[model samples]
Target: MLISRNIKMADVIHMNYFTLSVLNRFGIELGFGDKPVEEVCKKHNVDIDFFLEILNTFVDKDYFPKKHLQSFSVKLITDYLQTTHDYYHKVKVPEVESLIENMVDSCYTQKENIILLKKFFDEYKQELLNHTHREEEVVFPYSLAIEEAYQSETPDKSVIELMNNYSIDIFQNEHDDIEEKLFDLKNIIIKYLPQPKDTGLCNRLLFVLFNLEQDIIDHSRIEEKVLVPKIREMEEILVKNFAKK
Candidate 1:
């Protein structure tokens, strides 16, 4: 169901608990006292429409509103994406790492395999960090520049030059399949790794891994589906105008 302003904030959480993380990225906390979505968003100074769109897209996998999401400013979208990166780095990554450490500790017979599992996850984590770092340092700034130049009546020649040097198409083409390694990690745990003595630890680790995988998938979808295409459209317009000049 598409989230709306009139929907209760707490009810939204009930609808999909994953939204709690989404709310956190928005800097929203959970003490709204039965207020509606609009009220809570307003209190938190969030863009109600954007929040609703993001929530609806997250909750209902089939409900991506590409055009609507694209209509929002690039800064708004990128800001949210950056916060998500922060969450992954500061919270999710550490949490997963700790879980893996505990899982390895709980294992007795498959010490080598568990050590290998840690090695695999460590590699994946480094790759993920590198991926997000590139976006934060390069792609996101380029995208923001494109938006700024596109909005300007007199687009800057420098930004146009930057566009000429790098295009969203190039980034899209070079986009690493980070999730592939994650899927492999999951398979290794499920199919190959001997059952850890603490079954609960094993289960918890798998659960967190699955959640992280899905979250990353959703995050990438926004970049690939919305951010890239929107920037590409602006790049075309800016280039055409620059050529005319």
Candidate 2:
């Protein structure tokens, strides 16, 4: 397997909110009441009943249990925002404010800079949007499916083995795209602003950029280093057990 082995279940699960928020932002909303398990389980080649059990566990834990979990419509798109508050406050917002400050100072004052900054942020936003979608629609759901399989009590190895076919189409591709976007942001910051010697505005911009970089790095670390491995493990185990038939 070309997949990283250090990926953890916690990583992907933690990112569930991130994906949901991203989808919500893009208007591709999903909810528990939407029959996500039925749709997603089918995509990932997992059993629906087993998948429901996992959802119920989350419900018991009150992970996102709205309307008393039981009353919560399974089809309703639950609030799935991940815990990126620290990342947003500590990194993303500061960096963005800084970037905005820089734009106000430089771009507005300088005609060409305005166009450049707009273009940059526009592209940046697009990349992020795409990244979140893949995670929500593919990676997170696939991981959920695997979690269901891994935890299943079925004695029939084949029943437990279905996770091997776990497929989150386009997840890997989107990962690459996100990595490239991070690099692009870094390169732009490095190339466009050498030093914040001008004023507090430049300093602010640099801060924002730095924070965005941190968030992405943190996000990627969670996804690549933590989530990927666990999913892969689930897949591998399922494959082996599935072969027992």
Candidate 3:
């Protein structure tokens, strides 16, 4: 999509491919009514500034702040991340799996291909859930503890010890690999999936895969852009101000 200064908040998806995904990621459902972005956001009860910030970040990667995660609590972002995990596990993954099942039964000639797709999806789902589990069980607790104590000006000894043993750097290094398989899943669907006897089923599968890919990308941005950077800054502060004390 060619971006231009003329692309106002009122522009519709017809005008900007990226805006539609931005709205969708924020759970906004809109038609191409060409409504101003602020009005659309107001109708959906979304904070206009936050929505715009997200959209701008999506449009321009450099727009996201590099130095600090402010204007919201780390707890708020972490809790939202947890909700994303729940949605992925209980809703998103299951919905896509069900779509595959229906396609398998309906696309008799493509059943084998559908089966392969399902197996790949199941593997991806489990891997994602496992990743979420590690963040929830180990990283989040420690991150929040550090945040909680940092806010109180009392960095706990245990959190410091825990940080020494576990690092977000490890997670950071592994994240790209985890996302790599999903990219392969998408390309296989887009390029190599045998034509389902039912075109509708094929389209549905593609829609779900495309949406899931975009959603996962947004989720990763929240983690890498917001959570990791905030934690890194917090750790730096803790070491300098509290470590020797």
Candidate 4:
């Protein structure tokens, strides 16, 4: 995203210990553990400048990608996207479910609407899982095939035909719809719903939704601006060559 910071690599972990997620977002492992950020970057082959900009995006919601794939690895981005999907399905979604349970039990007086909210969140989770499943099962595998084919000196014509048949643009179309459900869930909780008497429970539910919103925003941007663009460019090259042949 935006490269608003000129911070040193060693200083990043110090800025926010929780920022290790940023490194994970870049497909960098945290084997560094308590080590300096610079050492981690060096070990991971992470470009220092890229790491800070990505870190800034999470730190500040105002950050936007000025030039998304420049000097970035498509494989790394895809790996990071997959990691994010795993986090969503495993950690984020389940955490929301746990909070919903806590809210329901703690606020029995307000169980009806909270149950409805939980039902809605369940559907939302299914939608998200299906969306991610499509990416992992179809889009990503096809994209990787294209990357392999196009990178070769003599690209595979059959592979080009295969990748061309299933377009990334298809996924792009409904990305907003998937995101809209989250927005709907958040709004329902914030405005229209009958909240529980336990203010902490209500607040916890809202907080989880808020964090999910921000995470999804960054996740979508990477897919839209970085991964899709790179794959599209490769698709264009492979198709053009296949046509000439």
Q: What is the TM-score of each candidate against the true structure?
A: 0.92, 0.53, 0.77, 0.81
Q: Which stretches of candidate 1 lie over 4 Å from their true place?
A: 66-71
lDDT for each candidate structure? 0.86, 0.47, 0.71, 0.73
Winner by lDDT between candidate 2 and candidate 1: 1
The digit string of per-residue lDDT tens for model 3 on 155-195 reads 56776787788767766876764567778887887788777
Q: Write the per-residue lDDT of candidate 2 for residues 141-180, one digit (tens) a residue.
A: 6666665666676534543434435453334444663546
State in Å the error of residue 192, model 1: 1.5
Per-residue lDDT of 207 in model 4: 87
Query: After superposition, which runs of candidate 3 have C-alpha atoms over 4 Å from their true positions?
Result: 1-55, 66-69
- Highest lDDT: which candidate? 1
Cα TM-score of candidate 1: 0.92
Clashes in model 3: which pairs? none
Q: Residue 209 CA error for candidate 2 (Å)?
A: 0.9
Tell me the RMSD of model 1 versus the true structure. Answer: 1.8
Which of candidates 1 and 3 is the stronger one according to lDDT?
Answer: 1
**Lowest-sum lDDT 10-residue window in model 1:** 63-72
Query: For model 2, what is the error of residue 100's alpha carbon versus the real structure, in angstroms, after optimal superposition?
Result: 2.0
Best by TM-score: 1
Worst 10 contiguous positions by lDDT, candidate 3: 1-10
